[model samples]
Target: MGKVTGFLEFERLEEGYEPVEQRLKSYKEFVIGLTPAEAKIQGARCMDCGTPFCNNGCPVNNIIPDFNDLVYKQDWQNAITVLHSTNNFPEFTGRICPAPCEAACVINVNGDAVGIKSIEHAIIDKAWAEGWVQPQPAAVKTGKKVAIVGGGPAGLAAAQQLARAGHDVTVFEKNDKVGGLLRYGIPDFKMDKSHIDRRMAQLAAEGVVFRTNVVVGEWPQGSKVTNWAKEQVSAESLKAEFDAIVLTGGSEQSRDLPVPGRDLAGIHFAMELLPQQNRVNHGGQVENAISATGKHVIVIGGGDTGSDCVGTSNRHGALSVTQFEVMPQPPVEENRPLTWPYWPMKLRTSSSHEEGCVREFAISTKEFIGENGKVTGLKTVRVEFKDGKLVEVPGSEQDYKADLVLLAMGFVNPVASVLESFGVSKDARGNAKATTEAEGGYKTNVAKVFTAGDMRRGQSLVVWAIREGRQAARAVDEFLMGATSLPR
Candidate 1:
């Protein structure tokens, strides 16, 4: 606590955003971060509760109060250190994470919660601007070798930790660069790719080797690929080379709507559309890229991915945009007392929606209409919830014109070939069969193999991915050295 009554003295201040009209002209990050003074005041709002539920609330278990006090007292360097003690990348989480910590804040019980995410964002950004962030290479080599598949957050976090433990670590990415979904799935307008680039530099300086454009599984002819390895390497070869392997590949299989006109030319998955723009941003050529420019676009599935589609379409100069959600809209305000310290069901309007979007709830697409094998419009119907089940209304059907349709229904599981190649077992949900037990956590039935992240737990937040990566690294270290000092 900076002052005895700091929480009472200071009012909450949130970060500002660029005007929607101006931001819609281009695909770029628009949320402005807090300044030093503003962040300090926000830090003062932390209650320093006897039992900080915020720690348990955050998937990464960040030390909230300690860092808050540090920032309030002008010890920014130490604040960053405290933050890095638990979280591997606050910058990534600060921008994209949904901030479950705020929901768990004690101040949230009566008034506005402490802006923990904003303070974190400020601290890390300041550390980078001051050139305080550096690579901490291990002083001695353990002579242990580790191999990581997939360059997503989970794999990257595990690789970074393992490298710091003095193990010879190598990361394999099928694409031309690192960051699995973070690189391609997420639109750069929310988080620029430069964040990943800077972290890549740090990881490289810390002795982690990266090999991109090398698909681990079988690549069939005519398969979409950025680049290829001169000599293909099999799962058996990887097992032979490294002492241990961690399968942290994300869930890549997208759920599809098998309605009529499924083979229409203009209908595509959100992954197919989002990745093309990322490729263009990376200076790669994409022939006839999918654009909503001057076209009426309809995005099915109302989630983060769908919101991303909405943002991207607006930036592409779309004539009109509409989003569909199968479930009925939630209440604008949550029941605070009932949902305290837990995530509540409520309506969340993202900045992308503000840019320009017609959000429709309790709507179902009946069919896709096409002409000349190209999608032209969709037939839809309204529905209502009854006894916890949705029932379509008989006479509430409608039609809407659309040139582009993006399926953002979310992923099902990782590519089956990747897991099958390793002979790893899968859970009922099609994820890698593994537990988080400290004694035998992340260990696969196959010798010296482990799994984590979406590969192990299915689709989840980036913060949880980092937590799994750190824990999986600890488990791998213990398996190799009989014991380890890395945090679980």
Candidate 2:
């Protein structure tokens, strides 16, 4: 509403990226955020739509119009204030979130959507540069203690909220550092690790305690979920010590392809290769680390994780990189008239895909072919939908050479052992069973225990994790004090 007809006058401008040639040389953030002027123009493009579908479209229900207006008026401080009100970590979402909000933008029905993510990026970066982001420690202690298991976005969000509500909050992270998947699963080229470290400092200053390298429950033996815990704390001890416990662990159990020769040495889960690269980037040594150097790499799955593998493999100087998806390729553009104000399915080309990748859709791997216990290639078949079921195409069998295979089909659920240790029940999908209602929501069948984020809702977006964390904090506060002032 800052400019009534501004939407008609402005065109969308996207954030820039460093040249692929220069960026592949190092593992650092390559995104060049929108300048203040460009952000203002982008903000001005926000139409004064009555419904503001973008707000509902965003997982955290951010006040999109308000922030857009603030940015349009050059009110940098208020823009960030509005942003942080809904999102605890805009930097993360601004960098990695797919911007479903933009898909639901009213302007996107016919024209390009306003660059909301870029504006958010500008707002948060400016806020930090101007020292608007600082510690907001609670003035009085509530005389209550809360334990948050997992230091990913959800756990961190809950810890910050509970700490600000005057409760003693401690976050237990199995890895040597916080930022569960963000630190290891996501490549540093998309978002630098410094963003997470900066937020950690702010949380610590706000009286949130972090216990890194500490697993609060048992880890399954020989599981490749990237545990770096140096110490262990029993679930019973947490229940005895803390007033409430929030399970916000990530969905770490990756879905596997059980075809023939899956036991090949060079074939690994995306997690196995990704986390090792991240550790190496952070100056930590990993023994026998998986590398793509001079190898023909095949990444299975077509999601963000697979795209990440593409980027990392390119950075590793792989001889060639190919990705596979069983599903048919989506249309290059969605029919906005039929899917307006909702997320629509369409072809998505990530920056990693733009770098260099041979994407094969409607293709399924039949078997992994190997030599001497090492992957050498894979047999595949083109698939087609027949009578509502996927069926292999006749005479479509083929083989492709590959030296390494990375399975990135996404995670299935949280580690079952941790839930078992807490005596928490799970949904049919293996995620912790919990509701999101206002009354007794987020509470598990077990006493004084709650679950949220990927642990409760299965693998999801960072924005959804933040939303669940904030709501779970409210639920816990209500359970501990019989009432809560925190927002749901």
Each prediction's TM-score versus the true structure:
0.98, 0.99
Error of 1 at 336 (Å): 1.0
Across residues 1-488, which tens digit of lDDT does each residue of candidate 2 receive?
68899999989998899999999999999999999999999988988799999999999999999999999999999899999998999999999999999999999999899998998899999999999999999999999999999999999999999999999999998899999899988899988899999999999999999998887788778754344667889999999999999999999989999999999989999998999999999999998899999999999999999999999999999999999999999999999999998899999999999889999999999999989888999999999999999999999999999999999999999999999999999999999999999999999999999999999999899889999999999999999999999987
Give candidate 1's error at residue 103 in angstroms: 1.1
Model 2, residue 184: C-alpha shift (Å): 1.1
Kindly report the root-mean-square deviation of model 2 from the true structure over all alpha carbons: 1.0
Candidate 2: residue pairs that collide: none
Model 1 accuracy (lDDT, Cα): 0.91
Q: Report the Cα lDDT for residue 76, model 1.
A: 97
The alpha-carbon RMSD values of the candidates against the true structure, listed in the order shown, are 1.3, 1.0
Per-residue error at 381 for model 2, in Å? 0.2
Score candidate 2 by lDDT: 0.93
